[model samples]
Target: MNFGTLYRKSAFTDNPKGGNPAGVWVGETLPSGDVMQRIAAEVGYSETAFMAPTTGYYRTVRYYSPEMEVTFCGHATIAAGIVLGETEGDGKYQLTTAAGEVSVIVQNEGGVREAALTSVEPKYTGASDVLINEVLSALGWQPSDLDGSIPPARAYAGAWHLVLAVNDQNRLAKLNYDFERLKTIMLREGLTTLQLVWRESADVFHSRNPFPVGGVVEDPATGAAAAALGGYLREAELITVPATILIRQGEAMGRPSRLTVEIPATGGIVVKGTAVPIETE
Candidate 1:
């Protein structure tokens, strides 16, 4: 049972201790879903990326958490990009995922390696009043606690997330919720995570993702949610077109991460970040 050459990389930050760690496995053939799930559980990260080459610069990729498989994952993708760049040389890699096709470009600038991933066609849908109310109750937040400017919606950029913006940064910092109850709600709604955010400026925001459905309490840095947010903001006419935004996450967790989101006039959102190898003894 040869798994592959596994690399441990931290995404969205150069400092190994300050980013989300992901396991990247690049191999000749991917293992069965059950084996992959078990391997991910053993890795014990938020997500692990499994990649197998399909053709030139094209690969089949799958994502899995400790508990189950996910359609897509942003941080893990970034980690894989860095690994591919270091091992296979910097270039563009086309990824075929369960949700859609994604492309990741790996580059080295001034000795710093970075990767940019363009998500699948992003979109959003209105959140039902019932669902919103239930989520709010689970989070112990009132309607007034929400930012009226950004209405509730279910946003998707490969994976689905419930976007809920707050007016206060303090409110975003103090995150505590019913784990089992929220997990149940998220599973029932087919949600990957809750994109909880607080806007600091027109192009800067603070984000926290509750990934109960993924069997994690919180995600330090979430690229999928950030891409979804960029699309939702534009589709909802909250932000101007052809804009770029900065997402600061994982701060509260002490593993700070930064994700750069570029929103074009019309297309999939592009997420840029840097990943570094996590050397362990």
Candidate 2:
């Protein structure tokens, strides 16, 4: 069957070239898992979002990659929101996802239409060095490459991630890994992506994500990971409560994404970004 209309938007960055680009499929109904996976692989974006309206104002959504389906995706959600703002009008849209019902606030400001998605309840747990070692081995990185401040954690918002902070920027850039091995470990651990980060400044972070489990090598911008990082910072008491942090990602791959994360003492996190439509020939 011919696929429905699709929109390509780069989430997190205002410009089309920047941010994590996502393919959004909007229609009365989404395709089957196999079809969606095939389409996602054909689209070649890290993640593609599919949406169908629910009973009320809420919409049911799902995310797919070249290989499989994921519980949730932050960048794709943002991209869907921007599409809604233009097509469905600017306002709040409630989405029913596999994870939970998430609310997106859509608004157009200064010619930029953006969406801020409130995540599901975020939580973090301490990870053992043994588990971290498995990931390090697959990534061909040493334990010393990590920054000792945050420690390693299995963080979750809408999806699960391993948050690894590298001490040196160079370590973050040289991302060569055994994809199959990492995918096996991540699947066993029930992880969606491995969040690799380097702090560029006090409030700014440069990040990368290895998403082998999802059939993608890396994610330029990860909203779910950003929310998980905010939760980790709060749970570990690494940052001040009720703080706002900026995450810069995808620069290594030349697709820059900027995610704004808001952390409160206790609550679900808010990940904000803009999605611009990318014309396809």
RMSD of 2: 1.8
Where is model 1 more than 4 Å wrong at Cα?
none
Q: Compose the digit string of candidate 1's lDDT tens values, residues 1-281.
A: 75587889999998999989999987888999998999899988999999996236899999999999999999999999998888888999999999889999999999999999999999999999999999999999989889999999999999999999999998999999999999999999999999999999999999999998878999999999999999999888999989999999999999999999999999899999999888878
> Model 2 lDDT vs. the true structure?
0.88
Q: Quote each prediction's TM-score.
A: 0.98, 0.94
Against the correct fold, how does model 2 do in TM-score?
0.94
Indicate which candidate wins on lDDT. Answer: 1
| Tens digit per residue, CA lDDT, model 2, 1-281 | 54477889889887788888899888777788888888888998989998885123578899997788999999999999988888888899999888998999999889888799998989889888889999999999999899998688999999999999999999998999999999999999999999899987767888999998877888989999999999888878899888999998999889888899998889788999998778777
- Model 1 TM: 0.98
lDDT (C-alpha, whole model) for all candidates = 0.93, 0.88
Q: Write down the worst ten-residue block by lDDT for model 1.
A: 50-59
